[model samples]
Target: MVENRARGNTANAARPGSDAGVLVVGLGRFGASLAATLDELGRDVLAVERDPDLIQTWSGRLPLVEADATNADALVQLGAKDFPIAVVGVGTSLEASVLITANLVDLGTPLIWAKAISAEHGRILQRIGAHHVVYPEHDAGARVAHLVSGRMLDFIELEDGFTIVKMRPPQETHGFTVGESHIRKKYGVTVIGVKPPGQPFEYATESTRIDAEDTLILSGDTVLLEKFARRP
Candidate 1:
């Protein structure tokens, strides 16, 4: 049985490929969190979940349907193809994840974001037309590894080893302007911005002085950035 709680509000109100709304499949931890965040951002989201209990749990919180996304018919009935963006958060089971992603592709969903438990699973999702494949657990673990070092305040790995990090200015950088330090020439990392203690963040310039109490935002190859952060 398929149950749609968005009958009146979203049934025909949103146009296909419109940015006004999104279609989210599954109600697991990731799915639920995505839906809630989208809601908080003021975006209309239609969440689809197979379990009746999960549906009931999120009933008043979000507009959702009780249907198995692995079934293409259920997605069609829920108007999945009408949304410009669709997210498949069924990563617990590889088979189910693949089926849901494939179904979204068959429905011609414009953009698909699917979660994968492993690299192989992500590759399969990509081959099946998922626009973005995310490995949440792997990414979280990697992010934690960087933060645990105590030197890196935050880290964001973009692609192909390129990364951005927020950290304290190393001792060598303190008490000197960016031009005098020649950090990029010596360490291959560019200090993009700096936030002095109790002051607003400002873009880094050759004249910008680095103080010991300031936090620096730098971008470079991950390996080089780590080496620079380790400076005594």
Candidate 2:
């Protein structure tokens, strides 16, 4: 398992706290990104996947467990119940996803987040007691459609139901400091990050300026988000 000790900041994770260790079963893009981001924000990670090569690649990067998360006993062996939160991220494989969700419920894995392929799969996850169920592909497609329409760049929903969105800076808010533009005041969206021209996004800074080409990643209510994104 990988553990980080960064000073000052408390951890931010999709899983709950109290037990620092996090078990990410399934090392697909989403699982891998989730593990990395959690570690980047300083949480201990214990990652698992059925692919031997993928496990080998990530071995020791975190406590990489080479096992099929779909197996009930395997997850227990990997100490999944030791953590407060667990993520079941098997993609496309409906049986595997269902089995893993069932396993977590059977083992009483406190908070389980599962990825599903359909509405039916979502129902099964709910039946098995998944704390959260995500249709990542659908969600991503929605954001991409908006982006393709030149209306948004990216969108992430933090656990609290607050939407975090990156979009082509709106006309009124372009070319202003975060506070000067008053995104919070006018749109009620918090300017969590801003990308300036020819520069990478300032991910967690408020003082960053909003340039014409800049994309703003904001956090706020969904209604307000839709309002900001819709064409005038």
Candidate 3:
């Protein structure tokens, strides 16, 4: 948490404007990373932090403002109302997070993304006008568990309980045609595509052959996908 202090540039001087500009509130891990990455992508970024020390430290690398983001007046003075998107990066402090988010909402910020500490926090953030609520810790934990299980080569979580996984075709399914394998019937997963070790990707179809060395792209319910992953 940034202590209340004014140190870095806080002037509302003429600022640059582009469709790529991003407003990041809070100089914590998520906010800092997002700001840096966006800057690397050639986008203009305005990062805010209450801590004078943090503002001083990071200002050399990017545009930063030292202010209490929970203060609506401060946000307005910082010219946050014009930002196309604002990300509230303080997830641990529910009060600070909510206040900052609400301030952005009231400022008519078009898109607000908030980090949430829990399910309840996520719900509240969404209800309070957060366009997107991210649970980084929970999602990272799920990814780690999948990696440790060694069933999937990669995983991408989609909306709700669905997921996309890349894995070698199970031994039992090798040499069988996609339709013959009956994966959807047995595992409740769909094989969207496949690729050989050194070959280009090909769409999976009823006649596509499933080889042991073929990497399959499957998508379905998270539970069912994990079940399939454990098979081979």
Which regions of candidate 2 deviate over 4 angstroms?
Answer: 1-15, 156-232
Residue pairs with backbone overlap in model 1: none
lDDT of each: 0.86, 0.74, 0.83
lDDT per residue as tens, model 2, 150-222? 4667766654557777777777766678868777778777878876667776764556677777777778886
For 79-182, candidate 3 gives per-residue lDDT tens digits of 99878788899987999999999999899776677888798888888778777788877888888788678568888887678888888788999999999999
Which regions in candidate 3 have their CA more than 4 angstroms from the true location?
A: 1-20
Write the residue-wise lDDT of candidate 1 on 1-232 in tens digits.
0112234533444344434678888899999999998988888899999899999999999989899989998888888877888988999899999999999989877667898888888888877877778888898888988877758999999877899999998898889999999999999999999999999999999999999999999999999998888888
TM-scores vs. true structure, each candidate: 0.88, 0.66, 0.80
Candidate 2 TM-score over all chains jointly = 0.66
Best by lDDT: 1
Which consecutive 10 residues in model 1 have the weakest lDDT in total? 1-10
Highest-scoring model, TM-score:
1
User: How displaced is residue 3 in candidate 1, in Å?
Assistant: 33
